[model samples]
Target: MEFLQILDSDIRPGGLIEWIPAAPGGLGAWHRDPRGTSHNHEQHLRSAHDYRRATRREGGREAWLGLAVEFDQQIDFPAVQGALLAWINRHEVLRTHVRLDGPDVARYTTDPGTVLLRRSRIGWYHDPRLLIEQIAGSFDRATTPMHWPAYRFATVARAGSFTLFFAADHSLVDGYSLVNAQYELRELYQAARERRPAALPPTGSYVDFSSSERTAADAADDRHPAVAVWREFLGGADRLPPFGILPAPPTGAGPPPAQHSHTTLLLDDDATRALTDRATALGGSLIGALLAVAALVYHRHGGCRFTTLMPRHTRHHVEFHGALGWFVALAPISVDVSDDPDFALALERTMVSLDRAREGASLPMLRLAELIGIPPEPKFVVSFMDTRGVPGAVEADAGAAVALRSHTYADDEVYVWFNRTPGGLRLHSRFPAGGDGPGEAGLAAFLNEFAHLLASIAAGG
Candidate 1:
């Protein structure tokens, strides 16, 4: 309450209070072992903050948010900057910092905070070919655990035009938030540039939602039905089998070069509608269609039974939707399709398995990691996430604005990642470049071929 007046703003009846009370530092706070997961997490946070500070000094505001905006018409940068500052001053979350005590963590306020917004504009290019290279090279590596308040924005130019890029810490926001923010900012930029009033929407802040969700999640007691569902689904299978044969040791084999590749498969609006129509005709949902197709792909590539992991958002469960942080329960779905199997039946089984998994969704990812003895590094992790876009998830922020973007890291720890895109129900497999050690080109080709195979099945060909 005392800090509320620090920014020269009137206090409101309902607002998030910066009440950390000098608790433990979040960086050092560990729910599990202090040396293993916690240690690595701590190091990552410190290094990330330090790197961001350095980039800020060099690139200015844009470096902080990793944002670069280009204007077709002339606009005043300083005015825009001023407006942003005022907006920040009024928002308490922007000026807040986290304090780390050994075992407990708390949020607090800090003067002259390290986080700052920077801007730059570029015009004209000396060497046309080098322009894109320079701009592309300028972007900072993406961060994880998205947090919105920590985001920064910057602008730069090399050719006769300019663009804006936003760089922000990953802890505060998620992909859904980034999309909403972009739309809002575009409206704001247009209004300011055109000297017209901006039309912004009213929405709740993530911080507020997160706080409430945590309380509710902690209070839930009914676990019978959910647990039973999982028990039935898992049956007597104690563990999931590795998809492929473990390559022989070096001298002759050292695990046939890891088959790693990532690509996105999308179903546009029309395509999605058609897919849905087809599903209804077959008595299934769009998700069922996608899963059946994915199962088919796995069968072809692995030549054996495989399990895919899907996160249970618990949207249907009154206890979970709209919760902040991951309420995801990993449900390993097994699909064994013969050379030619019933697509509709395959879909029905997949859907039923997932539903049961969600019902018993208390198992966390880390728990699974420990149970499987998944070494520090893993060959691949096949995962699927389904969350509503910003439009449906959170009300639009009218006071400032919101955008949603995501930065993820799998490294060698994870080989294959399967995700769902916003466009339609199509699944996307994202992989890091240089995933295959040598003969990268050959590995890339294999990935392409595999995707083509999947796409073919999706078309019901």
Candidate 2:
């Protein structure tokens, strides 16, 4: 799926139609679930910090993930409302509320039927740019980690078509859940129109997953192997891995630079398939080959080694795959490319580095941090997710699905994701903005090199 900002999105202007959740009734007192994990609690602190820092800086907001979808048919209010409410009821995570307790986060949940949405016609927008700015601001204010009902749903309605937008705090959802949500929501809307039950699989509750994981992780201590694995990976490094490819701003000259993003077409479908076969024939997987390509590029640019944190999902079962929640663990992967080895040897080192993933994601990042004495921010992440098998992601992307966590204000944070889409293998990165003009050009140059290296393997060079 293409994760993007609304500024990068293609949306038409229209009258706004929002199905807003009413004030939750019968909410039990916010009490800490001892079964709760530290992941969300840690994020709450980070969000608070980001919000305060962002208010002083320019365009940035706290962490929120979102998706924008298109509807080209005539409006159907009743069916749409039914579909939205049914969707909210189906996901137990949506039925809950969160608030910051003294030192921890507390949550209280209501039964399915209690959560209801009231329809409102917000306004009309003729200028698409103004509409975009308005929606982005609305989303930034709508979902906050410290508030109850941390998600909002709205549709920018047109004559015979509309674009539906949904935004939720990052603590409530992840990229996977947002991508799949398009499929489920459409099915629910159709079923609502027909007055039939939506044919959806039984989804496991993230609440239960959190409780079980919290209890299970309570057994971990300093002697745990994951602890050792994380401790070694960090090596007393506090901030994220440095960007040897880009120039850093003058030290202490000012606040950290704002961030920008770049996405490029690495290879077409035919070349991607050939490259996959080539990697297989070389006794290395596609992921390993891609990592080798990146390591080579990093080393070519006067780097000592290539190192990054990778995200691994905690959804071990099929059921959790369909749920909306932040269920992920971070693992460290570093490779010594200073030897200047060729693709074969680099792939070998890449494979060895990947072995770290097995243990790094085994524990929650918070627990890993407590074990290793490092905080969670300032992380340099490089992740590869082979999502070619995921049904409906292309359709969702066609409908303008965006991740919406952009407009960040970090100085040294960079996130890179390699996705195996149905079309081809592609990588997108968010790095230091470096004040815009030269930053964009430099990232493009860097990614072009990355693409050529992959193309070399695909063409048997």
Candidate 3:
């Protein structure tokens, strides 16, 4: 699936339909003082960070995640509504909201079967630009970590087909959950129309995940092993290294420009196989090959050790495999590389470093941060996902499914995500572009050369 900020934001439009949570019979869904549940460490940390940074927000930093897909015909509104509610009830995280007041944050959850939604037609929109702006603005306004039901859904209908859009605050869901939502919704939609139970398995609740994770983290002290990994990684530095993909910013300049992303395919299916085999020969997996190349690129820029932030999914519970929640843990990964070594040798080192890194990923970064006495923020992130064999992956191959993110303000940090699918490996990067980085043509040239080098490796060079 092609993940875009606003799915096909440049395309034309016809009409718009918005779906938002409503009080059943206008009696308030979150009434009767919902029961408080344990908010995960990530959620509590996110709330505290937002509270600290709330005063400095500029141009409304919209930090929502979204997904948009199309169906051949107009939506069966009633059937879709039933399916949506069923899907929401299936994932308890969607039914929960954060209470950001008090000294510490808490989560209050509404029970299933008590929630309702309303469909409102906002008239026709022949202009695509205005339509996109309206949708994005709604998402920015509706989605905030501190609010209840921080999400929005809409339908953009055309002559014979229509697009379904769904967005939520990033705290409530991760990239994997956001992509899988469309698949689950479609399954429920079909069953709702057929008036039969969906042929899907039950999902575990994120509530339980939060409770268990928090209990374990609270018991961890500064002496914890994970805490030591983080302390060693950031002992004295205020923050991690900024991705040196672009020229350094002038010392006197203000904050760097807002982040921009570049997406490109790195290798094709055949090339991926060849490269995978090559990587296996060098180490034990493909990540070693990927990390080796990236470390070398930084090495060329005089970066001795490849250090960056990485995300590790906490999906150990098989039951939560299909559930939606922010079941992600962040960890720091660093590997040593040498200039004299061949690429194969570098991969060997990377493979060993990766195993050590895996063993170090015990607690969430925020919990580790609390142990290390630091703040949690983004800087020099490198993420990779192997999406070759997931359910509904075939549809993504055709590019119907996509994960979306809202506009974000940034300083000097850079983030790159690598996705491995049957089609190939794709790279998507977001970085400070104007104040410190290369211009339009310069960035394109850099990316083209980067892709070419990776392609050569894939070709067995």
Candidate 4:
């Protein structure tokens, strides 16, 4: 409760909120409330994915979320390290350990003193690209226990510049949390440099969030309104329609291996602005418009209706606004473009479905899967993250600098990510390289067509 009081002061008018450790046996003993806290719905889904990957022939790749920030001038290495440590001490999620041995595998925020800082330095480098790749490579190889600390931090230094990289498990942080962590790191570093206390407020632990989610899920009846909505959306289908243009082979001719490849589509400033304006005029989000375009593409390719997973941020709680951890979940959105011949009509239908999906956004995919008895694996995924006003990309101070980037390890059949940038928008589509789904060439062509469709829709054609 005292910790809650500290968090309450964080948003007070004027000045930064300074954390004061509670009296002995107060905040320190909070973790002892219950051993092995229950796993939240998101954790269950993530763990399932992890398990499947582990069982594969090559095993699952490490799910690493990476961030890189470049500085215009030299940085104080020790100060940055201190800032990272300070951040770990302030946020419980950073200190939490994943417990995998017991009957119930849960996450717990343990003592701050016991939390260790994993830091390494990459010696001098002339090329920023090399430095970035080296940092990313290091992250790609790094691994952590599902029940252990979930993050690592490193810095690459040159004569007059430096880049900071933080890599953590996908279960540890989501896209939003990754950006939030960078912002907090910047502030904490500045506070450390000035020898002034950081103004960061107390944050709720991921454990607290898990407990709350468990309670809410239990209290809700099985026949809740959301359950019915999910039932209708699923419509007794066991598996989503395949996304590949080519029919999959019945059996493997050789080894059951998998590969992944991706392509990016960039929209110029004018096109991006027009697309945003058109979406606004249609009273929908950029995501809705994009979904409409995707549906149309699939419809034209001979599939009239199919289900796609859409990522939704689940940090609706006030305490979680800036909390670090994975707070993202996927919801299935069924697209039926059969009835609507006109693109405009199709867009309207897509918007309406999207609106309804948002109403039940809080419902977890794992729960929906159970209730609807649909296949657990997602065939196609669509995600959108708006980074219009984040602090990492821009130069915060004269000599100080920051940048953030993220990568996923899961090799889904098809995954499309949309990121909003200062220049315009960047669409990255990834799919298995040689799997039954569309091959690399087919995916590239699909992306090209999708872009053209998006442009035409934006032009109100």
- TM-scores for all candidates: the values are 0.59, 0.91, 0.89, 0.79
User: TM-score winner among the candidates?
Assistant: 2
Mind giving the per-residue lDDT tens digits that candidate 4 earns over 1-461?
Answer: 00011111111111111111222333344363353342343454356446657664222144556454454456776677678778777777666555544444544455776544544333555554554455445554443434243456766555575556566666667777765666688778889888999877667766677667656765666576677667677673423443453335436445334434443435755888888788878776677788888778777766677467788887787788778776766666776866545666666778877866775556565555556665666667788877657654334211232223334434445667787655467776545545555656666666778888888877766
lDDT value, candidate 1, whole model = 0.40
Angstrom error of the Cα, residue 300, model 2: value is 0.4
User: Model 3 — TM-score against the truth?
Assistant: 0.89
Against the reference, the lDDT scores of all candidates come to 0.40, 0.73, 0.70, 0.58
- Per-residue alpha-carbon lDDT of model 3 for 366-392, expressed as tens digits? 666666664666567788887766677
Q: What does the lDDT come to for candidate 2?
A: 0.73
RMSD of each: 11.6, 3.1, 3.3, 8.6
Clashes of each: 57, 0, 0, 4
Q: Which portions of model 4 show Cα errors greater than 4 Å?
A: 1-60, 101-103, 118-141, 199-203, 236-265, 392-412, 436-438
Q: How close is candidate 4 to the true structure, as a TM-score?
A: 0.79
